[model samples]
Target: MFKTRIILTAVILLALVGVLLANMVQRMAHLHQSDAEYLRLFKEVVAITKQSYVEQVDDKKLMTGAINGMLAALDPHSSYMPATSYDEMKVHMAGAFGGLGIQLGTKDGNLMVEAPIEDTPAFRAGILAGDHIWSIDGKPTKGVPINDCVSRMRGTPGTSVTLGILREGSKEPLSFKLVRAIIKTKSVKAKLLEPGYAYLGISEFQERTGEDFERALKTLAADNGGPLKGLVLDLRYNPGGLLDQAIRVTNSFVGEGLNDGLIVSTKGRSAGSEREMTANIGDKQPHYPIVVLINGASASASEIVAGALQDHKRAVIMGTQSFGKGSVQSVITLRNGDGLKLTTARYYTPSGRSIQAKGITPDITVEFAKKPAQPEKKKMPEIREQDLDGHMQQVGAPKDAPAASEPSAAPMDPKEQELLGKDNQLARALDLLKGVNLLKAGLK
Candidate 1:
């Protein structure tokens, strides 16, 4: 009888605690009319699923799916990262990661490639800018989350991943079976295009990009035998990376005198979100004519660099409009090692121009096009006796004219093939730089 009384007392206490939790949930739900209705609906669905579902589903999986759905509805950039996904993100931010090396985003409910990192599997596979990813490994990508696509594409190095791509001009989707590899990005690449003209390609801005860019400039100067007369800063296919690196890149061009001038600014709801970034006075690059190359693939930090340099009159912008991704994502880690990449702020150019949907417009627009192969010249109608004006007796059977010699095609180095690859954009940038230099000399 005593044992039975003890069990009854424990049951009574448990019933009281359950009653208290139910009251708290009711009060929270009543905070707003819509909240109350939604909470009711949420409970109904969960109760129904638990009682009548085909198979038993774990509560944790159900809660995780709910959270993912909620965040997905917010924006394309905001999402909940599972523990594994969060770990991969940490690796990416650390500047080295394994994957196909293509930066992609969701566009029109489909996956689209923003840009492919240089020297990576994607780049080596001839994946050009503006290619739409229709599917991955035979799975359709329509309405798929960007994070899901990223997670699926990235895996162990040397593993094969097939992508169904719909190129801009192609009539049908093309399939590419690519082997993923560890992508080690060389953020800054520089070489002299000519005696005094330099070409610098910034693939992406990272923690080390600022210093790497400085080193590249010095190397270019040494190659040119002096300070570079002009530079073609190629941010064409660069998908922006770090915020600090963007400011540093802009500073490299703008130099020391106006270190206090605004480079870029951020505004958010939080107290500390509003801030202006500026350049620092250190190892400033020489004042030289700069032509910045951009394209639809350039975005975020890349836009910051372009906008800052343009506003300061430091570089002449060229190429098509950028991929307008002006928002900033702050990664917040949760207690369970998961993370939330939330869009906490929007980026503005130095002139207060919002870069959200309206990307940086180039001062000069240069559309990319492949140069058509030259057609072979037809041999002039053989000089016939009837057509000859003054028909003189042919001294002897004219020896067959030697077959026209064709120009020998030489193999181009990777750098040359990249910069001048059938596109007129880079060529135009170089011409603009030369024009600037000529005008400066004329003024002198």
Candidate 2:
């Protein structure tokens, strides 16, 4: 009887395994069929375009346009890059490139100057934030795609590009001639706010950003005669860069004492794309009060650092809301030296909050008090992720919720000797840091 029972159980287990294998095979076959159908449809479309188009379209151009359209339909960050553009991107990551030194974007079908890097051609030429690019050279830029505008601006060093800009109070478009050069920016700048208080400004993250930040902090400590009582990290107008540099910067502040503490996590379709970056105990700065300054231009890697510090309760975030750009784009190089900048993942803060369309709100809101003589009726507002042409919506985000908005920064006074002296936001951040230090001393 025992031997008969064992034979029946074995038969049952084998039958169950066979059923599971059959289902797996069926699923794989269905996926293969779907892929084949998609390819057939795509080929049909290409064939029709090749035969019916008015001009003799080159096969290479058709393929490139199709790839670009596919990625553009996915999200704004996803893009197809040619060989030259891919080379330029590599130069940008290495922290040097020849161009106007300005970040570009599109707003309501018009080219907009997102922010001008300090001490660059655009900045020196007096290209203010929120300026509408009316024309590039003599051609109207009314509906030009952003990538095309970028290509027009970048050229060999010592070449010049002309821009027709429309400012807020200008009665007509103004033209400025800018000469391009290899712009090499120092990512980190530091100074002593006062004895025991330091001010550090990160213009952008680059290859050596982490190393530069550590060296800046050490120099500030030596200048202050001891460890810092408080520090203000300024990320205003900082367009973000490499993800590894963002991680390195965050690790400097919050990772040392906290073991396996979450900094950020990414979710994507592939198992390999999902990742969680954590901080480990290592060489960390002292437990001093930190205040992070952000504005509408802070984005990408900048948002990562700010979100992580805010989530970990390691710093007080102050200023206007940041530029919402929480998607991660991975540059995948093709066999022909071209590349595809594809949006592979969405980043989440340590507290599991996705700041894709909704940026980091300041813990304390501080606005600079400056009124323009004539504010443009249709002012270019802060460009967030939602403003992009095909930005990805956050996963599980509310469909009916309105797009997030950022407080517009007061127009800067160009003639002012020291803008920081009149910056209300910076003043408030400094005061907060000072108050925290005072509280700690009193408690002791």
Which one wins on TM-score?
A: 2
**In candidate 2, which residue pairs clash?**
none
Predicted structure with the largest lDDT when compared to the true one: 2
TM-score of 1: 0.65
Candidate 1 backbone collisions, by pair: none
Give the per-residue lDDT of model 2 (tens digit) for 156-186.
Answer: 8899999999899999889999999888757
Q: TM-scores across all candidates? A: 0.65, 0.71
Query: What is the C-alpha local distance difference test score of candidate 2?
Result: 0.81
Relative to the true structure, candidate 2 reaches a TM of: 0.71
For candidate 1, lDDT tens digit of each residue in 1-444?
A: 999999999999999999999999987777777887899999899899989999998999998898888776766667899898888767766676678889787678878888988788899998877899988999998988788888899889989999999997889989889998987757888887766777889988877788888888888888667777788899988888888988887887665676546898888888899899888767677878888888878987998898888877777888887876777889899999999988787777776777666577788888877654686565444222223232212211111110000001124457766767665888787777777777666676
